[model samples]
Each structure stands twice: as structure tokens, then as C-alpha cells.
Target: MTKKRNMWNILLASPFILAVLTCFIVNFALDRQFSWSLLTAASCLYAYLMLYTLIFGGKHRILFTYLVLAILLIPFLYIIEYTANLYLPQPIYWTTRLGIPVSLAWLAALAVTALLKTLTHANGFLTTGYFILAFYAAERCTNNRIDAFIGPNDSWSLSDHYPILYFSAAALFLLLGLITTAVKRSRSRA
Candidate 1:
């Protein structure tokens, strides 16, 4: 029974492990550069732990509250960062750079929150699936609308390859969601 329980634990954790590994592989393959900030890393680690606990630690209500808090905090944090950037002496371009790390932290929070909620609610597949759809829609909308705000002198072009790239990413997330659902279902049957 102990061994079986261990196996179950491993199975339950596999999706998150796979997601982390895939992120590493993609980062390496794409030669993407990411700054390893301590704050961001800590946020991610805490989020992961909270998510795991929320899913399997029997603290469902507390975890759900944390998830809700995280979701609400993300936009508020962004606004704070934006306000800070405006008052600082740094160039406007630096806002994007500074914001990216904070945004990533928020995104990690969101993902973990979602994962916790989905697991507890037994709606992992639906939550992840809809998240992808929402992401795609937001990406499309942002890409189309952003051009209007940028001046001609701005070096950034809204016509870049982001739309296709984001669409492909959405597809990948959808596939991952499907796989995670299958795993969860199989585990439940065992």
C-alpha cells in the first residue's frame, strides 16, 4: 500500500514536472535569455508549493483563498510597477524590461493558482482548456490594437511574428491540458 501510494504521488506530480522540464528545454532550444531574479524565483517556488498543497494537502479552502488573492493581486501589482516606472528616471523602454520579470512572477502565480483550483475542483482540463482560449483571444486583441498606440518613431512594430508564435503556443498549451487530463483520469481509475 505504501508503494502504491508513492506511485500515485509520483503520477500526480508528473504533469508539473513535465511542464518545468518542457520550459527548460524550450528555453534552451530557443536560446532565450532569462534573468534569474531571486524575488521572481521565490515567487514561483512559493506558488508551486501552494499549488501542491492546495491540490493534495487537504487545505482546500485556504488554498482556494490564496488562489483568489493571487489572481486579484497580479493586476494590482502591475499597476504599482507601472506607477513606479513612471516616477523613476529610467527610460520608458526600461519599463518593459522591468515589467517582464514582474509579469512572469504574476503569471507563475496565476498558473499555480489555476492548477490548485482545477485540481481541487476536478476541473483541471476545463480550466486549462479555457485558459488557452482566453490567452489566444487576448493575444490577438492586443496585437491588433497595440499598433494604434505606438508612434511612427517607435522602433517596435506591431507587425512582428508574435501572432503566429502565440497561436502556436496556445496550441501547445491545449495539447498539454489534454495530456494532463488523461493522466488525471487514468490515475483516478487506479
Candidate 2:
């Protein structure tokens, strides 16, 4: 019975994992980059964990399980460093060990998932959106210097001059996440 149920869970969750994995793979072929892919994979992983827990059934005590899954993926970042020439190790290593660590961000995401078990409301959207935005912001802010092209020869590449866009996005998502949390709280009460 247990084995059969596990199979059912895997079968249900396989499509989401495959789609996110495909997106990560295709970003390399189409854009020649994995920075965006890394962000997507991390976001998808968070949602996957939530969905997996929901299907297999974990309640109140699954936070650490989800957190372990998040930590395991830190090593996964090495793949991006190799393929995209992004200097990921130093930032992640230093930040993870010496400071707050990326795992905390994932923990927050999972906590939100646990709080809002159903993904059919604004809370659900906010929870997934928060994870996506937070993970992306973490990646973007840690090593934000990029040589992005805006037009033919009109490039916006310098890190010094291009802090605005990334910062604004991060700030906006954070504010949204907070507002969502407040709204979710009020809804739960009523």
C-alpha cells in the first residue's frame, strides 16, 4: 500500500518537475545563460516540495524536511557557475556560512506553504510568488553585475549604473510578500 501510494505521488508530481527542468535546460540553449534558470529551478523546487507534501501528506512537522531539500540544492548552484561563468561560490559560501544563508529564505517559503495549505486563493498565489521573487532577488542581488543588451550597441551592462532595476524589483516583491502575509492573516481570522 505504501509503495503504491508513493508511486501515485511521484506520478502526480512528475509533470511539474519535468516542466521546470525543461525550462532550466532550454534557457541554456536559447539564452546561453543559467542565471534565470537557477532562479526558476529554485522557485519550482519550493512549489514542488509544497505540492509533494500535500499529496503524500505531511502536516505541521514537515518544515525541516522541506528545509533539508532546499539546502541540498546549494551544491546544485555549482552547475550554473560552471556553465554560465557566474561567480556563485564565493557569494553563496560567504553568505551561507557567515551571514543569514539562503536556506532561511526557503524556510520562509515553506512556512508560508504550510500556513496556506491550499493553493487556490490569493494566499496561494502570494506564497508561490514570494518564493519565486525572493529566490530570484537573492540570486540577482548577490552578484548583480551583468552586461545586458538593451538594443543594437545600446547596452546597459555596467553594474554601477544598473542597480536600479534589480533593486526595484526586489523591493517591490518584498513589499508584496508582506502585504500578502497580512492579508492572509486577516483572512484566516475571519
Candidate 3:
């Protein structure tokens, strides 16, 4: 069984290897340089890592996947910036100022997701609440980063950026989860 699983893992990895090879070959053939293929290789590596981690991560799959993402994302973004700067006509430097922070924000969101999953123990309402709250937070963080990058295109208003409805819904869902858990515990005790 272990041998078969290993074989299957190898098979799963084959496509990513093929894609990377193809990208490198095509890139070098067309451009006589290996610039763009770096991006492809980096992307394939990240994808394979995430896939492998998720598949073999067992009960801790979510946490493992999140760790893989958190660890690899910034380096991946760096590769992106390196490739873009090298290949593009003009260098629009945004990696440190925009990409990293936004990625961190999303990572924080994922952390919250993992936390919620653990906390809820598959209670649906809690998961929904956490997801909604994380989504709102990530989106708001992204918009804030963009606003910072662009530098005051228009006058900023709190209402324009914030999703009050989503926040409220998330709060409601959390309340529901708490009530449900309490009632469940009370019944179990009785």
C-alpha cells in the first residue's frame, strides 16, 4: 500500500515536471534566454508543494497547506517581481510596498481560517462566521494597500472601504455558533 501510494505521488508530480520542462524549453527556444521560465518553474514548484502537502497532510491538511503557502508565497512574489522587472519595459516596483503586505494580509486571513476550523470542530456556523470575517478583512487590507500604492486618487471614506454588512453577518453567525454549542453541551449533560 505504501509503495502504491508513493507511485501515485510520483504520477501526480509528473505533470508539474513536464510543465516546467516545457516552459523552459519554449522560453529558451523563443527568446534565447531563460528569463520567463524562471517564473513558470517557481509557480510549478509552489503548486506541487501545495498539492503534495494537502494530499499527505492528513487531519492537519489545512494547517500544513497554510504553512506551505505562508512559507513560499513571499519568495514566489519575489520571483514574480524579479521576472517582471527583467522582462517588462518599465520597472514598476511594488513587491515590498504592495505585494508582500497584501500577501501577509491574506496569510493572516488563512491563519484565521485554520484557527476557525480548529475552534469550530466542524461546526458550520462558526466556519461561516470566520470565513466571512476573514474575507472582509482580507479585502479591506487589499483595498488599503492599493490605496496606499496609488496614493490618494480620491478622498477616502470609511463607508466606501468597509463592509459593514459582512461584518455584521459574521458576528451573527458567531453568536449562533456559540448558542448552538452551549445548547448542545447542555443537552449532552442532561
Alpha-carbon RMSD of each model: 13.2, 11.3, 2.4
Model 1 Cα lDDT, one tens digit per residue, 1-190: 6698678667766766666666556655665642222224334445555655565556475656566555545544554455455557983543244444444544564565476556656355546555655555544444444443353334443225455665566567667767787888999999
Better of 1 and 2 by lDDT: 2
Query: How accurate locally is residue 118 in candidate 1, as Cα lDDT from 0 to 100?
Result: 63
Worst 10 residues of 3 by lDDT: 154-163
Q: Write the per-residue lDDT of candidate 2 for residues 56-131, one digit (tens) a residue.
A: 6556436545654566556545443443445454433333342234445455555655555455354444555555
| Top of the candidates by TM-score | 3
TM-score per candidate, chains pooled: 0.30, 0.34, 0.87
Error of 1 at 72 (Å): 11
Q: 88, model 2: CA deviation in Å? A: 13
lDDT of each prediction vs. the true structure?
Answer: 0.54, 0.57, 0.87
User: How does model 1 fare in lDDT?
Assistant: 0.54
For candidate 3, the lDDT comes to 0.87
Q: In terms of lDDT, which candidate is stronger, 2 or 3? A: 3
